[model samples]
Target: MAAQLPIPIYSSLEDAFGGLRTASGQSVRWANLAQEFKSRFGREPAYIARAPGRVNLIGDHIDYVLFGVLPAAVEHDILIACGPSMSPVSSNSGSVAAHNLDPRYVPQTFAPMLKSAPLPTASEERDAENTVHAESWHMDIDTKELRWESYVKAGYYGVLNHFFPAAAGSTTTGPHPVPVDLLVTGCVPAGSGLSSSAAMVVASTLAFLAVNNKVVGLTKGELVEMAMENEKRVGVNSGGMDQAASVICTPDTALYITFFPSLSAQPTPLPTSRTVPRAVFVCANSLVVSDKVVGAKTRYNLRVVETLVGARVLAHHIGVVLAPTERPTLREVLGRWLGFYEAKNVPSDLDTDMLREGVQKILPYVEKLRPTRDDGELGVTMEEMIEWSGMPEAEFRQVYLSWVDVEATHFQLYKRTKHVFEEALRVLRFRDVCFSSEAAILPRDTLIDLGALMNESHQSSIELCENSCPEVDELVRLAREAGAFGSRVTGAGWGGCTVSLVAEDMVDEFIRSMKSTYPPYKYLGDDELREVIFATKPSSGAFVLKL
Candidate 1:
């Protein structure tokens, strides 16, 4: 019942992928895909979902705790060609067959398993209302290891549970949504910071929703949440930033996505000079992949724990009790403090500026309280955190550590929290520069200034967040030397891709120079290098296309 297909349907043979102002050759591309789907599925496809990969323009590592992030959807994307299965192939069940055009990923076909597939526990389903109904059959995908198809299964299960809750038994009477067949192909580089996994998940969810006609009434925010929860099944504790960007973004613009009170998005216009009118973002791969999934224990999820623990310790030290619902985002803590200061200090005639400044000054950066025992292991002990909090061990563990096991002792509390706040501020400033009136007077300088912020962001990620690796920093240096105005690692750092604010006119030379100068590129063949190291325009958000 979606007002329109998530993707455009091509009624005219002429329009295939043409209606959405799809990339230059994308129209032809979709037309060909439709024919290919027909050949593979033995029927014409019912729908196609397009979810573009994203590059974090400024903000990084701050989104999951509900922070504002600026990101743009790139041209590279995961395209899901979907059609109903022609046969159930069994008396009791149906199946979803998937193909990877790239062949790098093993093809996957999934079905509803009544007992063998592990469904979510009632508590894990997000809410009481979302509990698995006796009639609801939410087939669980085994994400035990590095299975390529885990992403596909995650998306399928994500939408399945959301729209067509499987009634526990196959005998239960309900609307029988045909099992779907999906053929996925994409230009997005996998394992790079471009968010290819998110694109795949979003694209698959759209396909399932579209196939069931469940898309009509659902809002974008609802879909965003569903996709995020789906990803958590794969063990990565993601914030909605990537999924939000894929869902809410528009073509040729960056989205300033804020997630404080509610998920809201505003398009921030990029200033491009007449000659260089379109913002040119060059994504240079560091060739390092930070697997947020299994590595969740040591990297991304570990940082989430650190921030939570830090917030608890900070709150206890300052005598501010945390409300059960409040997460330990520094921004939220400061807001609460501001409210308290106003209530108490106004009567004392305290200078408002001094009171506000005093609040920041009073907040301490206690490294001893950090959960990380070693930055290398990215683990922290309960005893260390409890000692720092000056609170009961049980209270600290229940409030902050929760169910996670902190196995390492070294932590970088000062650095990680410092990066989140500073980077959050930088994202705002970077967005302001794009909108500032003076941007016209010094457009080039303005872009350069933006790059400087990126440089600072990378430096902080390395020095403080400890997310950057040797290759990540080296890539930034090389991109800078290659005439990038500014560049920094995009995604979860460690290894992935770098986003360089490149001058439009200089992009060709910039990419070429980077290839020649970087040692990694020395090994990639010309065609491979061309594809991986290229300039990108801010592309459209996730959508559907029909043939």
Candidate 2:
């Protein structure tokens, strides 16, 4: 098995800071919040919190299923500078001074804060939820004005509800018990299938805990749980992997993690020599949103797993022990027997012995359902099943047979992915720099190897997974033609983004070609067409800057 990414940590702060310099082009100056606190409250600031956005290079849409995903923190991060608030300082005072005031910062009072500011235009408000805005930040206060910052505030409230419910009782009243005044900022691209929202939630939890002086006492497991609960406040049902990855990932290692109610992370290194190669990943937006497809597929996958689990429970009643993976085969067998029993072409109802034989005939087909090579090929092309279904009978048969062949191919491809990742780990282990290797090496080679896998993955996603759309397919082709090493659609397919690996030397050429070939259809000059091609590398998870 491939090694997983690590859970992020506070100790990685220095390296995380280094990564941020590259991302934001501004060196992080840990806010001298302690000094600011003294000036504001006549006391030292109590705590700090940091959170990072995540990029899924491969294995998109698999994390929520408890399946493995290859994601890492990007250099972009959200840092909260917080301290106890005091009355606003007098403008005439040349020196700053702090005085203790009520800690209760009522959320409802936020409405009045909005009234003090101008309202955003109707169009700006509609896109504000997912897209970033500059002018709108100064607009009227409504739930929407909260934008990215709201996630943090909501998460803080969530933490409060979880840890101090009595204090958060509905009857409680005050300046609305302000937990913290968070100054949030980040560089992670929004709506690109990167876990920007998850980072915000995780970082918010960390900030809340830090302000309360609770981080030092909490165990790693406790931290992950706290972040998970915080995300629940946003109404997004997610397994804790994204938060865990942000919290625990080291510099050069990819943390392979497994989560139940808690988390376990095993850091794996990349394959490389002393001179680690510089690599880049090209993220090409297909201009398609993934909400509906990703959501539906997630639910469907969950339902299938649940049904299989229920089948296993019933099988145990008949004195048979079966694993969940085996339930689908068993169900198929039962279906075949039922089909035989109801066959009008047959003279009579089949006996158990005959039904058993019918099941035997179907077993071969059931077993072949395992993922295949063609699945990987199809994934690359971004094709849909409906498209294939429209083919003529002879062509369909040929495609169907090729599809059958994909099962074995996909099994081999999965094995190949595991082998490459493991070998990369071995290389890092031999270097005796496992920790740094994770921070540096793994991210580079993983992108390269992952790029290769992406080609195959996209092929399979299109052919077998049956989630490809024409626009997505065209984007993949455009990326490859633009000189990407390999390209594939990321996320739940049918449209989202296509992740590509571009050689260092070809980066400029690739960008130029993509821009010329795929010009914006909706926007003209001066409109500042949103960048469709983004270059990224592995980065650290969230953290707080005490500026």
Candidate 3:
């Protein structure tokens, strides 16, 4: 049971990082950002918002389908320095002037267009007692091409609609947002699958919330929900894993986040055997950019539709009755197979043993989804899928394909379901090993056990989910040959980064081996290579710095 705590705010760097030792270096970096903000915008910042990127250790594509995932906050993060603007143009209209530390992203200035309609009068409201009146706010976001300020606008859109309603004639009583100037700086590499997009959204969201005086009583869970909804505005239907890990994770532990019953998280300590050498998770970027927005229609979004449709077909095969409008996830389908529905009889606390048993019990039944056609094809066409779904073409398209944009001629229901179930079991097994290890008496093969699970997960991503690419595959191969206990693609696998388990003493040696053996690092200089690959540990999550 995770505690529901409001987002943290600190007056000093020392308090923000929880110690003077940790804050010493950060103080200089943050000070430099503030100084740069002054240089760019000609004013001292009032507040700074920080949010971290995350690396998923296991459970990749299953998160959108509502399964437990293990991910920890990386030390690399995004920071935003913002204050109210005083320009006459900005003062009259709630305009935002945004700049980034990186030159590739040019400066952008935009404002939300408020509606022209006035609010209903008190008597009119009383006359229409059962009716509700609402006005929508509009912000222009280009979903086709990736824009840096689009994320900023997405975050601000949520704040505008939720807090400030646009009504003409000054009839609305709610508060209006102030025009803001923000300077953005970050070390989280973009397109590396470390979730720089989520970090940006979280940091930007927090910046608006803090500047608007809406930070009071905003729980971590609420922030996660807001950020999740905010991120979808930028054109990727991602799971809550990235946003939740960025907001809710604590120091020195990986979060075990479950999504079915309700959004809850547990800070599970990643322990090592006392007898064996200590191990750390190393992130090595493949240098292959995974643009989720550009690739969503064919890769990410297609997988989502396939898995979802697979769940409905599986339920039909299992003699389970599903409403025509219901879109059940693989996890919910498994629950139904186990005789549980809508979270009834679901344990609040995560029981690895029970989850393990449930996966085992359902593994055989999943075979029912195998293609029974004699044509020797491994997948089903759209017509065949609709027929198997036991729904008319109109209803099937409405239920599954209307809300999301996905392009697929063939759907691999069997392969996708098989991978999801097996990968879920692997997650439970991995969690069990982490819990089994103790400081006093540790298993000699602790790292080996954990590494093996990671290896299995990558294989599933490659064969079943089909998200891994040649660059990622070769990178994983080199990592294992270079002495990683277990190495796999960390984030969305089309072209991102890989997380490897390596002994503490051998981290330098492991990096050296990768640099020499991997062709991508051959021409790079020391700093460039360092940025592409490095060692990392679980770090603290998002926070606000009051200047």
Candidate 4:
């Protein structure tokens, strides 16, 4: 006898659209029934999933470094309708809705899943017994989701797999097949650095779990970890904040989250109670897409910090072994071991002696090699130094002392980076103060401060953090001249969107000015650029509603 299948309750299209429109402010006019969504399986839909988009307000290029970031869920979302197929008409049409599902929508498998009975929901007892099996299933789903959708899909699959592997996993040679039809649609802008991608993944995961009647067994921390792992499966290499924000944030409040091995969040109220003098942010496109540079920068930053810290820890261990008479301060020992050459002033003749001498004093705490000094006079550029440290990983691995000594350079780099970061943080705090005070009531002044910070952040990112690109610089310039209060590159830098804080009164004016001045050159022409600028805002994140 066939196992009793969970009865799928399909929401009316009208209800789905109504709930979606209310939540996202996006219209979901169902396409022609016959053309938009045709079932490839002879069964009805059992469930639906909706995911939202997100925007990062601060902490760009810091996620891969395992640093904390502030992100908010936006009003934009991706809505997916999944259920049993009612007909085997090969719903493989070239429609907009079909295109959305193309990435993960496997027509053949979906058709079968719809035909078979839905898997039974796991009880608490069943969950405990199948925890290991469930985890394996989650990993498989994570892998499958990564193939076509954004990293978010990978996260969703991971959670589902961990909680309900039997149903989520694919199978062969079974009379009852696993067929799940997914129809996806969304309004989140792609590649906007708003983390729209992550939001969608998180929302979808929740929706999928809801439909399957599976419960997350882990603590809040474990749940976030699972979500982050799912995202990693998609190869985007992001932190867990986006998923956290999507699931945990509330309207009108910014969430402050700290993520290490686990996730913890608190809502920090906006400084002011009044809505006037609203916080405005603008976005500009850098017109370049170099994921490799962005990814490299992220990895490089992480490696530098780890290497430096690791070297220091190791040096402390070595200190314990040395005899009192022969022992030296960790700093002195490191300086001697790494070949210290000078202090305070790096000499003009930057030979091996100088390089060794310069690194000597701090060698105990250092972890990587400093980039060769640029000229005999000016030291090596920070970017050059970071790139150099990563150059000979294999050779450095062969020699223990050489490797640790070379690794010490990263310690110095991190210290320098931290100083710059501190300044930026100070500026942000000041802005918050200004916004909370009289400036909150004055719209124009608020914009001026916001813009100033935007420019300040860009300068710091370029000179201190070393993450700016020419396109970003150009965008900032264009935005400022066009009456934008402030504009800077968003995301991991090298290339991405630039966000500006503008006045509500001047938004239209600023948009018009930008359109006239920059004229929107590449992929999107002037008209498209105009449209994008007009549409962006500080929006809400993901949510679920009965339709």
The top-ranked prediction according to TM-score is 3
Per-residue lDDT tens digits for candidate 3, residues 1-547, read: 5537889998999998889998997888899999999987788999999999999989888888888999999999999999998767686455899999999999999776565544346763333322212235556666667889988988887787777864433524445788999999999998898999999999999999898888888889888988988888877888899998899988888899888767888998886424368888899999999877777888888888889999999888778789878998988877777776664566543356767788888888778878887887668899999998999899999999987778878889888999898988888888887787456756558888999999999999888888889998998999999888898887767998999988888899999898998899988899998899999989888989999
What's the lDDT for candidate 3?
A: 0.85
Which one wins by TM-score: 2 or 4?
4
State, as a TM-score between 0 and 1, how close model 3 is to the true structure.
0.93
lDDT of 4 by residue, 347-408 (tens): 22233233334344343333332334544322233344434434344432432223211222
lDDT by residue (tens digit), candidate 2, 162-237:
5444332223332222334444445444545556567777776776666555555455556666777655444344
Q: List runs of model 4 lying over 4 Å from the truth.
A: 1-47, 64-66, 84-135, 138-147, 150-153, 165-178, 215-223, 260-262, 269-279, 290-416, 423-447, 519-527
**Top model by lDDT, which number?**
3
Compared to the true structure, candidate 2 yields what TM-score?
A: 0.57
User: What's the TM-score of each model vs. the native?
Assistant: 0.85, 0.57, 0.93, 0.63
lDDT of 1 by residue, 159-256 (tens): 65555554434445545556778888888877788888888888888888887777666677777777887776666778888998887777777888
lDDT of 1: 0.70
Full ranking by lDDT: 3, 1, 2, 4
Clashes found in each candidate (C-alpha, N, C closer than 3 A)? 22, 67, 0, 32
Instruction: State in Å the error of residue 264, model 4.
Output: 2.7
Q: What stretches of model 2 exceed 4 Å from their correct place?
A: 1-24, 28-48, 87-150, 166-178, 260-262, 272-278, 291-449, 463-469, 492-495, 521-531
Candidate 3 wrongly placed segments (more than 4 Å): 1-3, 115-135, 166-173, 273-275, 343-350, 373-376
Provide the lDDT at 470 for model 4.
80
Better of 2 and 4 by lDDT: 2
